[model samples]
Target: MKYSTSPTPSLNNYPRSTSPLPAPANYQPTTASAAVKRYKYIRRLFKFNQMDFEFAAWQMVYLFVSPQKVFRNFNYRKHTKSQFARDDPAFLVLLSVWLFLSSICLGLAMTLTAGKVALFVLFVVFVDFIGAGVVVSTLLWYVSNKYLRRDQDGPDVEWGYAFDVHINAFFPPLSLLHFFQIVLFENVLFRETFLSCLVANSFWLASIIYYLYITFLGYSNYGKLVDSDLPMLQNARVFLLPLPVLVLSYLATLAMGWNLSEMLMHFYKMRVLQ
Candidate 1:
């Protein structure tokens, strides 16, 4: 009855408010905060927690003291299915520390200027990280998935699984050698001696062999999809699966001219001021 003469209140009369809402008291700008958060995230990403440290230590012991146990007990497929789970980060952290220390020791041995030493170490680490960690790992995964898959019949092995197996099998011994090279053989006489080089190469070769053996075991457990009667062929195929990685590693080293002793000597000769 009150609307008798009034035009029906049109919906258009209720104009919507365009004013922006005030920022919440707790809502801080994400610009600096986002960067800080990202920095923290990256730091945390690379940081080794206690669990990681303990696992890495245990891995070293298992790899060095009882490699067979490692192959027998460690389940590569189960761990690697989730990509970068389990010992992946641990291995990376260990490798990074090893690389850093080894580079420092090598720089000192080479008597290089501090700047040169830093540059050289950075270069070597960069090259190695790219070559072994990225390129060779990718190649191994491809070879395993594309070619080696035919040899096995179990679950379809993912590239991450192969990559994990490769890293675990290879890096432990390598890291040990890196430690030894820096700690025990830092002197010029040791660096120059043929025995030292021979021993180093011998250990390197042994590590490679051990990696192949571990990879063989991993394949035996996960990759072998064939009938029970053909176990030998399955074994052989698994054994050979890592050959591609080996070849790639060798090629990479050659291409990069990555000789630890040479690198040490090159820097030593620089004799850059401290």
Candidate 2:
């Protein structure tokens, strides 16, 4: 007689595992509102291992030389992910790191006390960059959603997207004002001569222009993405309206013997050392 056969165990016959599955390493909660998404982003600020800093560095580079390419990728993101603004906060994190290091370098270049240097870094990272960025982003978010949209019935711009645009535009200016200016300050741009004014004002001029160009690109790209009634970038030139006025102001500063770089240094000293 054959041995009695035992019934084989089946996965279905066995109770299914009741434990919850872990989310993806790159999991994003797209269904959340902008505020909730921002809270999540803020939560990830300290999780360095989860960040995509390599891509953030690439964004920093392209944001300077070929911002068009950067925005092109934003378009692709919209098509693939159903959003134009970045979900990853890696760029913001990397920028903060860079600003901290640059602020330290600036303090060293200026021969600042350690306490002063620390204070300066805090001021730049928290007050100048983040604080100002929040205000500017809020203003633009309100303005763009309220006034710039071609379709009032369609979806309005996200506040996070406005902040993303602000940070994107802010990066190039930070490199110029915070990094490159430190290099020039030891010998050249710190002088009180009219030539110093010319150089310093030129930096401001270039910074503002870059900021406007990137801002224009950001809003214009959004307009194009939304399939507006007007042609691409028709109203985007509004960002550039300040250019001619900026040039005139630059010339006026030169005429008036205003060394903006020196003024900026003094402002920093007053804020930090005092």
Candidate 3:
């Protein structure tokens, strides 16, 4: 009986195991949950999860202490779109109240009449706070679209982002200086004299530089999404857009103050003559 040796069954032809495979040796089931918990804790600690008075206070303080960090860490696409200036009136309201109070304090310190105090408060809220922001952001949007195009097909910069940048950049310096003008400075003379105008202009110029710095960081971070290049020339172009806006705002505020002073002085002179 010559039985030929048969070849062993190939392993490839065998059916795969139906049993569930074990998890990998390095895999831990808690890793993802731990990461999520950590993220939520951070958000809570930083007050990013809530939009309230505390968050507004944190934002204002953080603007003065670590402005670059604020811009760098901010999710522009998420927050700018969702909690925009229009959506959240709390910040503006808070700002208006602050300016109103500051104006009242300054006017009282200067011994101004009731009507003058009311006028000053209105000017601070309407003109300095709201009006300046609108004008500057609009001009920035126009100049950015016109001169700062990354390429022919680059995305047009949104007005909201410009407004965001301007607010964050200008708020710190303006608030700090205004506070100093009220509390520290013996006399509150914004544009009454040449020295006062120089001081105010210097602060405004600082704000312009800070604005440019924050804008550069923002562009560098989101350049890819915006189709923008972070070249020096492009940065310079973006910087130039805010320059005129800042200067114009400064001049306009100065001119307004000067004219108000003149009118008041004229009225006082006429009263004295009587």
lDDT of each: 0.53, 0.77, 0.54
A best-first ranking of the candidates according to their lDDT comes to 2, 3, 1
lDDT (Cα, tens digit) per residue for candidate 3, span 1-274: 8876997789766533322223221112222233454455345544523546665667677776776555543433232332112233345445656677766775675567787777767766778667998898888667766776656464455565567667776665556445654476535443468666555555556755666766565444432322222421155345546677777777786665543333443553344334
Say which prediction, candidate 1 or candidate 3, comes out ahead on TM-score. Answer: 1
Give, for candidate 1, the lowest lDDT window spanning 10 residues: 224-233
Q: What is the TM-score of candidate 1?
A: 0.57
Residue 13 miss distance in model 1 (angstroms)? 72
Residue 49 error, candidate 3, Å: 13
**Winning candidate number (TM-score):** 2
Clashing pairs in 1: 110-268, 111-268, 153-225, 154-225
Per-residue lDDT of model 1, residues 31-125, tens digit only: 33334433543566555553367766676678767765554334332222321224236655676777787767766665667888888677657
TM-score of every model?
0.57, 0.83, 0.55
How many angstroms is residue 194 displaced in model 3 relative to the true structure, after the best TM-score fit?
A: 12
- Model 3, stretches more than 4 Å misplaced? 1-50, 76-87, 187-233, 236-274
> Which residue pairs of candidate 2 clash?
none
Ranking by TM-score: 2, 1, 3
